[model samples]
Target chain A: MSEITLGARRPVIVRRRRWRIPGAAIPYLFLAPATLWYAAFLVYPMLQSLYVSFFDWDGLSPSMTFVGLENYINIFAVDDVARLALWNNILWTLGALVLPTLFGLLLALALNRRAPASTLFRTIFYSPAVLPLVAVGLIWAWMYNPHFGVVNVTLKAVGLRSWANGWLSDYTMALPATFVTFIWSHVGFPMIFYLAGLQAISKEYYEAATIDGANAFQRFRHVTMPGLAETHVIVLSLAVINGFKVFDLVYTMTYGGPGRSTQVLGTWMYFQTFQYYHAGYGSALAWVIAAIVLVIAIPYIRRMSRG
Target chain B: MMSDVRRQRRLEQTVIFLGLLALSLIWLTPFATVVLSAIRGQGDLLARGVFSLPKKIAWGNFAEAWSTGDFSIYFRNSLLLIAMKVPLGIFIAALAAYPLAKLRFRFSGAIFIFFLAGLAVPVQVTLQPLLVMMKQLGIANSLFALVPPYVAFGLPFQIFVLRGFFRLIPSELLEAARLDGASEWTAFLRVMLPLSVPALATLCIIDVLATWNEFLIALVLISAKESRTVPVGLLQFQGEYSSQYTLLMAGILISIVPVIAIFIFLQRYFVAGLTAGAVKG
Candidate 1:
């Protein structure tokens, strides 16, 4: 008993046999609380939701009836909102990928140099990113206010009276208007990331490019874009993820309304589960979101793991 | 010819400056609008447009937003949630990160990847069952119900950042601690944590902002007014004062002041903290 061998038949020193916890187990000990917490709070809930996805139950009910893949099937076959939501998510992802990434790069390029007030300009651009999205939604809602908002007020001042409209309530303008608000809040995200990426690009690359008779555009094309490749992957991935996870702005501003025109998956899931009381269907949407995210995030995760 | 180049450079600089100024003014316009609207009373705001200056400074709008908006309670609840969740989350994440960063283990890579995978798991995926679980525990309405899920959801990022930082601490320093008869726990507490302050500080900043800004989970789980967080509280403020434009603006202003102050002071830390566990790790 004093001298013991582990499972592999390798003789191991067991100085504290009563404790039975070996050095190998020490790391596990350190990891125990976190692992337990994840298993209980994170993993178990995930599995529970997975189970709930197969059922027909209001979230508050006493008992759940197992309905197999009916909810998943219904999402495709009958749920027009689901299809519209999926389409909207793709639109949001495309919009985010284009607008913010492009504008952010331009801003980063401008502010990358150490000119006077550059930092001040940078601060101004990125400041909106720090505010809560709920606040952002509210701010822009007021900004888009039909009667007394600044958008219309300024338009009227500029003699563009015909352009002033209830942007959020208009069926065609609602989603795009919300997207403009998104651009206002989200451009800073890509700006900061690209800024960091730009800072990391070595001056040697530029020097060599200049020596090779590369003009400004040529040097940027050959050097800067290539340098920011990893950052692009990361930034674009995040933009897509943010698109899938679009909730706060949509919820607080248009609230998937003017008759669900703004209903992305996030808001749609909330409507399904909480409002419509379709717990199982909502869980299915949740899983679908997870699946889509994982598809984008796997490569990102692999990229991160190398570090 | 040299003078021409200098003059050309000066002209280019002027154009760049003007462009930047235009963008800055455009960006600042939203905030300027809010400020203008905040200081004006209801009559003043409705009488004048949002873009106009305050005719009568209703500084009491802030006080009314604070009391009537119930932002005082919201602020307290948010602070309490942060206080409880941040420390507990950081400590637990740090503990796990210590082993994953410095120790030899069979499942280290797999475990790390597993945690990293959690990063991609959207809060929506777990919201339903988490709410059900919270209800079963009978803490669904309590602020305490928030702590577990907050800490849980925060783990993957927290651990990712902390582990990346912990790995950067010289291994020789840890070896020195080991030689000096310090146990793993002692080495972690004394050597690892102290050396990881920059990482911890960044994590603290990140955690505060995230917890403060989080909306949907709080929107779903918290139905009670007293237990409401800042984001939800702001939504309530919006609903109640939808027409009371000045008061709503004041409430929005009050909610953002703390984070904006943090940003202005710690802008460097903010960027560093935000990009901490990103691909560059």
Candidate 2:
């Protein structure tokens, strides 16, 4: 009887031990599919791009020669188009940081108060966000047409006809014109974000401020802005990252047009890889862009995680 | 004292109302112009200013743009892409997120960091190699060409957001399920999934918007006219009607209606989803 009981307990213990091994491995089991997909499609290609960046492969003919950083050097040395595109990217990043943040705050403040049709006002303000970049670009392209465009027509009607050139075609106006469309398309997202953040703040803060006889601006400065620090960081980082990656609008609207005056890093990389077939050089440019985003984002990530 | 405060609040409210009214008009004008231009008769479109009230409503313009631009076919293709991509992406993301959110395993954090790295790399870097891979697979110009890459690109962010929501679930419920002899899979399905409907709905709405609006991947993958999505179709319309503002506006209007309709119907989910990711992270 004693041996029978002992044998049964031994099997149970063995079964428990066996289960522990796989139980500890369960997370990997769940993560395997996604990791596999990422490895094959993302990590593999990234490494491949880096490897190919050292070669002079034109994307097709199988004969590859080792170029040994020639592609990177050449891209940096003689690429005026790249320089212009980078400048546009910087301008975009700056504009995205400032304009959307300000507009979103203003919109949030206006809608923060209880009012009739506030929901309608919020919806109207945010409608542009739901439209795809391609659609926005196409619509705005029509609106930017020098002759029949609403912009020029409105300018003419207002007796400011000389101020209106082909908004997207003129070399000087093209980039800023495109930036305006970008701003319009994106401002709604941060507005909604800021609104949610505002609502999350306790009413007691405001009440306390009022009791202290704080003015509106003073309350905003001391209460509202401080309360929105997390939101501010998220918005700023997302805006910067998105600014760096903007391509579709530029592609559909300008196609790096009017002598490549409106080209940004994203569009430039597209042209280099797809059109020009300088896959090696394009990869180098892509790495540069990624490095820029990382430099800006890593500190924020650390700050967020710490909080 | 109370009356003065009330009056001051009323005055402030009026100021806010007027300011919002002006801002809303400025914000809405571009959309209004698109709709008006699309509805205006060709004669009215050409003669009157772009913002003028239409002399006659050209309801036929929407029909014409739909039929002439082959927008119906494009719409179907776009729907198919979204239908396939969103579910598949979400399923993979959910499966991937479950373990990361629930289980304690070695390298879980490292694996997550790998996905975090993916969020920073723009789509352009991956495009060239993806094109090469598609060609190697010999489906370079087909609808299948678009799906794999879309899912690949979408997984990281989807997993990120879903994992955040999943992590917030109480661990005690999961342990109770385990005590009740439920397998991990069963526990996830029966316990976690029902509780996660809101988060899943948010994910679905966002994925729909992103997939439906995706253009760069569609441009690179789908070359045939019939397989092109709405954005590609709209691009073609722009190319073909380079000079005809009215027809172009008509095409733009047609392209936007589906998006606007979906957004309006799912506005709550859309706002919640956007705010969820933005506010939390």
Candidate 3:
């Protein structure tokens, strides 16, 4: 407690604390880097896009004339392309939401049986989910080729040669063809989620049901379906948001063609901004898409945060 | 009664196996065709369609595609960006997550929610201004231009996972370290980080896969040919060689090999991470 001893201890403490941040400031110091990155890159840009959406500037110009709500108005009133894009977005979202969940639940049920080679089959089914969407588009585009592609080749072999079509380039068939590849890659993703949920359900529930003379279907209806309710929300919301924002697959495969028939909101926004130089209009489209995703996602996110 | 129950279970297993086997074959057919097409020569492909047996294996197509497609440049750019971005993103996220999970601070709940909300905001909504910002910073069309946004976008999920992990690391260990006169920084580096290897590794795998396969951002930001990443490069390669299906397939195979290799190596962690994100957080 003497002054000289205190002075000596103080220097040692100062030396140790030089590299050690104080406890109160520790969180802030740790947070500074990530917060700054998000602020400058994500938050700032998000607000900037919102502001730009109300204007008529062509991206690179120095002056932007405010044309409040005009871009959104045009999407409904005059822009057939926008209407087409919105319709396609809906088709993609609904199909992805329904089919993937059904197929995923099916696969999860199959795998949950603990059959032989189940792990291998799970990996096989899940493999496509990891490949880049660009690669998915390329592989499917080749498989959909009218002359030598596998789909056509298989159809011809099966005595259904008439069913074979130019899948991606045929305007009427392109969207459906694209959906096949989407569903194929996505089914395994939800399967994994459902598998996790299935694993969490206790064996006691099934045992109790079985003792009551419940059949297999009845056990599944009472036990499995209710157990996976949370996972369904996660899977369905993710599928819907991703479907609304689909771009890479469409861009790589059809480039919004055979006459823009496969165009969705995400790619159409890019076409408006980068290709046509209607940057303000694209910003408007982007906001609308983001709004749709938020409308789907926010409720689930709120529920998650609460728990 | 027991014998009947066992027999029925055996029958159910058989049915499940056969069903999964058939579906697995369907799932793998496209990949098999991609690989098969990649090694077949144009002459062979023209003579006998994509599914036909190859009489002569043309391994030379890979070499030709490697050189002619300029995939090497694109691969290097992707590797460079991933190498820079993934570790930095994980480190920043883990650092922030530590206090949020362990240390009690004001507005921590609100801060956590804010980060979670970032997950729902699609990147397209911010694309224009981000491009403008990249231009202002003089990094547009360069690998450096991609880093900031990539790191930022990756942080929300990484932090969410890490916070869950850090919270499980009993506070008793940190308290023990403090009692031994360890500073907070030293405690983090020496105690917490070493315990977090599995979580960090999971994040690394996820982020690397995401950055390597990222398409849309690279497509929008990098216009220069040399600056393009693998996905964008492959897309342009397909555009230029639309009719050359064999070589195009080679390029596709080349692009996916690394990701498949990584997945095979770390599949357990990857699966755990995916489920953890859904089930827990």
Q: Which stretches of candidate 1 lie over 4 Å from their true place?
A: A1-21, B1-9, B277-281
RMSD per model, one decimal = 5.9, 6.1, 4.6
TM-score of each: 0.95, 0.93, 0.96
Give the per-residue lDDT of model 2 (tens digit) for B26-70.
888799888888887767887887788888787888787778789
Model 1 over residues A80-150: C-alpha lDDT tens digits? 98988898899999999999999999889888987779989889999999899999999999999999888
Off by over 4 Å in 3: A1-15, A19-22
CAPRI tier for the interface of model 1 = medium
Model 3, residue A176: what's the lDDT? 92
- The prediction achieving the highest TM-score against the true structure is 3
Q: Stretches of candidate 2 above 4 Å error?
A: A1-21, A300-307
Q: Candidates 1 and 2: which is better by lDDT? A: 1
Native contacts retained, all candidates in order: 0.73, 0.63, 0.73
Clashing pairs in 2: none
Cα lDDT of candidate 2 equals 0.82
What does candidate 2 score on TM?
A: 0.93
lDDT of 2 by residue, A166-274 (tens): 7788898888899899888888978898999998888999999999999989999999999998889888988888889989889887888888999888888878877
Q: Quote the chain B TM-score of every prediction.
A: 0.95, 0.95, 0.97
Tens digit of lDDT per residue, candidate 3, span A111-223?
88767878888888888988999999999999998998999999999999999999998999999999999988788789999999889888999999999999999999998
Report per-candidate DockQ.
0.51, 0.45, 0.63
